[model samples]
Target: MAGNKQPVSVLVLLYTAQGRVLLIERADKPGFWQSVTGSKEGQEALLATAWRELGEETGFAAAQGVLHDWAQSSVYEIYPHWRHRYPEGVTHNTEHVFAFELSEESTPRLNAREHTAYVWLDWQEAAQRVFSPSNAVAIRELGRRLSPLS
Candidate 1:
């Protein structure tokens, strides 16, 4: 699969203790908002994928804050328009989930090539704004995870 992408991906929910989650508008799909996400490169651990995507998409480093592996994965059908990036027969993707907490509210350095704009919204609003069901679920989960502590 010379030009094929790995079916494994990572979804990083970037949030603050106050439950504000960061979402980026995709350059490819202007209205589509999502958390930090990207496919895994050959042999890379899912955690590494999450860290790489976080930096690549938001210019945020895992070392700068708390990055937690939520130990969750979701299998979903690949979007038809984006399926061409994967092997011809690959129709599904497994996305691992991670949660990153910033020390406080901070602006994300958006990657213009992948994302055109960024916004920080309340976790509930962020969940509603995301285009992917899985991404939305992760945002809501982040809220649940923080509720007890808040």
Candidate 2:
């Protein structure tokens, strides 16, 4: 826990049944917005990491709504500035994807330390607003999943 950040993480996309998606602006990076995301700690399961991040970032627990494990993961290079959080040789992260769908639109009680603002937008708009490509892809997939027809 002290030497390096885990290379594994979870990315959670919070959305409504009607396809509205939530995005949070990073406190440290201002305009850099994304869905719920954090690295796994200890031996935590990916599902647990998803729920923990969801609660930490949005104050929403898995029991409050439906949490779907998309069973998908992405590997990407860690940004340079954030690399110090990880081990010296760690240049990439593997992010598991999850989806939380609320019955309706609702406000999120954000963690001020991690995020400064939050927004709920149409899936398309949410996808466009996110600074992370993986977050955008998850949003678009949410849109496709909630569409009238597959």
Candidate 3:
């Protein structure tokens, strides 16, 4: 699989039922906050990617609560520094969106190699705080989905 394209990844917007979103600062880029995100390993399914990344990056297990597949995907340019992880000609990635709602607020044990810190913010503030356009789009979608009916 060395030269094969990296499978699509998942971006899980971890939030509370009350609409607070979780944002984790990237260890590689301090002050850059985002939700759980990672590529699939081998032939693993995309949902599996979401579950695995959640556990690996934040110590959260999907079975313990709600994890919904938003059935949304976005393609965006792969940041230059991380492009080497994908195939030579691949310059973009398709990220599937998911949501994890915890029963209540909880502290995440971040993977120090991947993230520097974590915060819970109101959805609007979370959307503004995310660094990636695709990530921000996903946050907006989450807001729309969770908003109460008029």
lDDT of 1 by residue, 4-101 (tens): 79999999998999999989999999899999999999998888898899999988985678999999999999998998899888999999999999
Show pairs that collide, candidate 2: none
Query: How close to the true structure is residue 8 of candidate 3, measured as C-alpha lDDT?
Result: 85
Per-residue lDDT tens digits for candidate 3, residues 26-109, read 999988889999987898999888989999999988656799998989889988877767887788888999999997878998
Clashing pairs in 1: none
Estimated TM-score for each candidate: 0.95, 0.95, 0.93
Query: Which residues of candidate 1, in runs, are more than 4 Å off?
Result: none
lDDT of 2 by residue, 1-150 (tens): 324789999999988888888889999999998999999999999999998999999999766789999999999988888988998788899999999989887889999999999988999999999988888888888888898687
Kindly provide the TM-score of model 3 when superposed on the true structure, using C-alpha atoms.
Answer: 0.93
Determine the backbone clash count of candidate 3.
0
- Report the lDDT of model 2 for residue 11: 96
lDDT of each: 0.91, 0.90, 0.88
lDDT of 1: 0.91
Best-to-worst order by lDDT is: 1, 2, 3
Q: For every model in order, what is the number of clashing pairs?
A: 0, 0, 0
